[model samples]
Target: MDRERLIRYLSLLVIGVAAVLPFVLEANLYLLNVLILMLIFIIFSSSWNLLAYSGQGSLGHAAFFGIGGYASTLIAVQSGLSPYVTIFLGGAIAAGIGVLIGLTCVRLKEWFLAMVTFGFAIIVQAITVSFLASLTGGWDGIASPRLVSSQVPGYILIEYYSILAITAGVILLIYLIFKSKIGMAFLAIRENEIEARVSGVDPVRYKLLAFAISAGLAGVAGALEIHYFGYITPEIYGIDISFWPIIYTILGGLGTIAGPVVGTVVLTILWDGLKVFGLTYERYIIIGAILILSVIFLPKGLVSLPDKIAGWWKRRQKKSPDAGT
Candidate 1:
């Protein structure tokens, strides 16, 4: 327990370093740019993690993410409004859509829910490209206003700080949710639906709430990404976008607050590092292998790795003492 506390404190220290890292790096635009994407995905993956923790995993979270992006982008372009304000509107729109989807999944479990959510992304993509092509600009995409105009001096620095602030707020919000009754309901539902119902928990309400919160934040993350790039496209609903978060959460540690954070950081490093070495497709192969090993050996995910090693060492020492050598 003392060791676990130490690990947590160390994690906090690492976060502190990350908070000020851009300044230390002299705000290099390229580096800051990568960090910005990473931060956005952190929020993105964390949102998915929240839903999975609630026993309602989504394979098509990109639907909400793209919806948020399109919604915010259209609102921003149409009204000449700030992306700042429109992002929230985007989140709300995504949340509403999420609730509608959740209503259909009220009785679903596991593979059924996953398949439906996966199909939802495909459906949303079709709608964007066909039914809404006029507004969505079809496949050509459309411009989105930057969070901060590039004309400003040190705009990149300003943008980085602003995104950092947003990421911090989202993480804090998720942390609070995890510690509340809402989180408990999610856990109860995840662990056992019948038992959760017997305990007076309403799985439908909590699942919908989880879906709303998860989708809304995913939408915000998507909005921020496209806004950062100053464009929006239907490709934002790609299956990769949905899968990446699940990968991160599974690799990091499911159901724990630190899992997504740890997973995202480690994977991001490995991803970019592999790129530098020109691995291309091989990087994914390596990552896939790592994922398999994690599942087989470290079922609790990477967050529990240190504890696993520590316990092994303690057992080894005990066996050594009993050997009488």
Candidate 2:
């Protein structure tokens, strides 16, 4: 990784440890559960950023998320496999589906591509809902197999650290990819697809590659959820979940690496805090208001808030440096 990204990864790792430190010391289930949810969403939002930054607007992201959840959960429950193996199996399965979808749809432009992806998501959800007896549990969903099956759970701390380690690894991987040659190429595509094509860039290959990567990351997030929450339902694969990454990405900031992470933490905390008030639906209401205000005032996202505030302060300092003095 580059110097900047190395520092970011290190910082995230430290913060992740700190976030789970409560569980390590006293095993606060509430805090641990919240942290798990935040990190899972962070992974989801980060991967979605990859595809969005590449200029591919996929509306079926939850398709991969759901697929991963089911794949890992099924392996763990039915086959009695280890969690470690199932995680990767989930990601790989999602990646294969992503590649197929990407290859088929990447050639299209704008709304067509988005619509196609949206349709794919609906189809997946339908299949999950319909096949109650076999692959999916239908509308009822299935109970997840336990990753840690013991009541005492001696190595709970180990599990916490494992999640921290995996999340850090994923962040580092995304950082490296964004800093690579292909990442820059993806940015070029985002800037102007026609120009990128004119410059002899094969839009199909790079876009497909991005789709595979993005989908794989989403799969990882789903796998984590299944293990952490111990449940899988058709709701997990619906369009609502797909919209989450987009919402979080926009809330945090687009085109910035740290944006999604910031967005995930802030929104998750707000949502959790609001739940105690019994105004559960109000969380979305607040989020919607924030989204609107953000678009109106800070189009770039909350990440840009700092920069904007800093710039304003600098200008004021220049204009009235000695007024008070």
Residue 71 shift from truth in candidate 1, angstroms: 0.7
Clashes of 1: 0
Best by lDDT: 1
Candidate 2, which segments miss by more than 4 Å at Cα? Answer: 1-20, 23-25, 152-156, 198-200, 321-325
Each candidate's lDDT (Cα)?
Answer: 0.90, 0.82
Error of 1 at 222 (Å): 0.7
TM-score of each: 0.95, 0.90
What is the C-alpha lDDT profile of model 1 across 219-309, one tens digit per residue?
Answer: 8998899889999888899999889999999899998888998899889988988889999889999999999999999999999998899
Which residue pairs collide in model 2, if any?
Answer: none
lDDT of 2 by residue, 1-325 (tens): 4966776676767676666576475877777778767878888999899898899888889999988888888877778898777987898888889999888787787799889988888888887777544766678788886556547465455556666667777877888888897898798899998798898877778899999999998988888888777788888877789898888888899877888888888888888888888896778898799889988998898988877999999889889959556
Output the worst ten-in-a-row residue range by lDDT, candidate 2: 150-159
- Residue ranges of candidate 1 with Cα displaced over 4 Å: 1-8, 322-325
> Cα RMSDs of all predictions?
1.9, 2.7
